[model samples]
Target: MVKVSIFGSTGTIGKNVAFTLAREDTVDEIVMVARPESLDKVKGETYDMYDALAARDIDCRLTPTCNFHDIEGSAIVLISAGIPREKGMKRLDLAVPNAKIVAYYSRQVAKYAPDAIILVATNPVDVMTTIALEASKFDKMKVFGVGNHLDSLRLKNYFSRHININSSEVHTRVVGEHGDHMVPLLSSTTIGGIPLKYFVEYVDLDITGLVERLKNAGNTIISKKGATEYGPAYAISNLISTIITDTHKVLTVSCYLDGEIENVEDVSLGVPAVISKRGLEMIVPIHMNDIEKRNFMKAAETVREATYEVKEHMNM
Candidate 1:
């Protein structure tokens, strides 16, 4: 059976993930983790969303509990259980508190389901991914952050509209951070195998403004709504699907750095990576211009600073 456990299953991303997976026939068991007091909230919300499907008699199991032991035996664990950032809140503001949560859950995972693929979906995800990796002592490949996948999706969608092309025809990747420092690889981006520069020349689109729009996409969503969750839930669900099915798809996710990209160290940042049954299989390196390289380095610096803060608090 394809067993899955979602930490913070009562939260926006977690509940949406459960709702999405509940609709899938491939998911055999879903364990929802939350506080004991939150059990009814999860059940009520889930039933309210799935009652129609339940009336139709779907055959999937939805188990809600406060116990971490219930997460054992699951093939994948989606860590969406941390504070969501407010409109003006910086990623660093979340570092210390979320690091403690990562530590707590990492110990639980180590004790129970050490073999499960750990998907980090918390804000400041790149840094939180490092905390989870170190605290769990799991293979770096098995721990990854849902980073630029959502950003890349937004970028492609924007590009498609600008060039009047189908979104599937546009292939793009956002690298480095999952935040404002993220670098959109315009040079490597393509529309139907043609360079984005050529497409821009043909369409006369404002490339500079497009990059800024991608950077501020989350802010725009948060400004409209209270928080951004739907896009992330969709992106994370896709990652879970890839892991569950052992699909070796290349995606932009935050993985541990080992001096691989320009000697970047001790941080997790978004880069093109292959994901399969073994989790993150490979970090694919792509050539970038000087400006893009600098942007990536700046993002690495920000992640490193946050890591240092977390480490100081953990005394690690």
Candidate 2:
């Protein structure tokens, strides 16, 4: 029986995560944590867990509470509590506020659910992930951020259309920061054991424009729908499922910096990682072209700058 808790249960990503996990029989119980005043707000939602359980034929109960102490004994905790970025806004704009949120909850998790696998989905994800790691002082392997999974998904979707192949047949990754600095590994992309370049040639298409399009995919969605949640929510769910089931899946997650990528130091950014009950078990380093390497460095620098600012503000 897997016990789980969602810290921002009423928010867009949080709500979708809860709804998705609630449908799984593998999840024994799910606790939705919200601010004291927001409890009523959640209860009023259309697909709120309370309502879902009430209308269900099963005898299981879905717990919702504002108290952190009530969130104990969970195998995993998804932290989706943070501000969403606007279309034209930089993720750094959310640093101060989201850092505070991450710090506060980090202490709470340290106190109440120290062993839980903490999955962070907050904006300014890289910095907030660093804050959580420092504040919680938990094993670095046990805390990670939902970062480039959505970006990788977008890359695969675009590649599928370009190659006229099914998305499931494409294997690719978008590494580095989740924001504008994402590095798409075109060299590593493959369609049924064939290189992406070969597939592109077969289709007689230009793939250069598609790279920029994939990089700015989030802004496009935000411009159209105001905020992006569904894709990210699904990505987070996939990560959580791996941990809960001890699946040890390889995924792109924002993990701590330890000089694994050379010259990149002290920041969280998306890289291919093995996820299991240990949270982020291992960082998988992939080869990069000179341009992709430069972009990855830029992404690392952005996160490092943000981390410095967060430390200055919090005086940590």
Candidate 3:
């Protein structure tokens, strides 16, 4: 039976993950982990979530991490426990506090679920995911972050909205940092194999404004809802399902770069990668235009700067 562990079970993303996984037959057990202070609170919500699922004829073993002992034997460890970005907050600003939380849990996860796949879902994800990778001392292939996957989804959704088509008809990938530096590859993006420029002309759309909105989609949602959850929640669920089913699908996720792209050394950035039961199956290179190349490089620097900003707070 496949057992999955969620480290921030009480948070919005974690709760959403729990509810989504509760209906997945591939998941035989769902372990909800929380800090000791939040243990009882999460346990209460766990039962509430699981009971509701049960009423719908969905069932899975629900466990709490009051002791954190049962994190062992989990097939996947999703680290969503960290400082969330608030209104008017830049993702990089949450780096320090979230890094501390990520570091401590990364150590514990390394000690407990050493063989499990580690996926980070925190803000400034490029920085925090790298922190988790280094702190856990795990092979880079064994860990990653749900970064541009969410960004790409948002990009596709926004483009699809403008064209008045189902998002599935759009084939797009957003790369680079998961923040303001993200690059939505227009050269490589297509709609039903149609170039983005074709759609802009056909729809008489403003390309520049559309790209800006795509970049700030997160802040846009958080401004009204106080949090952005639905898109990320389902994005992560898709990743989790891909892993559970061992589907070797390429997703725009955050992984280490050791010459994958020149000049960026020892950092995590969002790029095309194949994910399967083995975690990072492979990294795929995207053909970039001159402008995209410059932007991708700038994104690398932005990610490194974000990490440096949080470096003083981390032991590494």
Whole-model lDDT for model 1 versus the true structure?
0.86
Model 3 per-residue lDDT at 65? 76
Q: Write the per-residue lDDT of candidate 1 for residues 1-316, one digit (tens) a residue.
A: 8899998898889988887777765688889888888889978876775675576577778888888889889898988888888887876788888888877887798889988989999878998899889889999999999989999899999988987889899999999999878999988899999988777776778889998998888778888898887888888888888888888999999989998777888899999999997898889877898999999999999888888888898896
Instruction: Quote model 2's TM-score.
Output: 0.94
Per-candidate TM-scores read 0.96, 0.94, 0.96
**Lowest-sum lDDT 10-residue window in model 1:** 47-56
Per-residue lDDT of model 3, residues 202-255, tens digit only: 776777998899888889899999998888888998999999999899999998
- TM-score order, best first, reads 3, 1, 2
What residue pairs are clashing in model 3? none
Instruction: Give the Å shift of residue 26 in candidate 2.
Output: 2.4
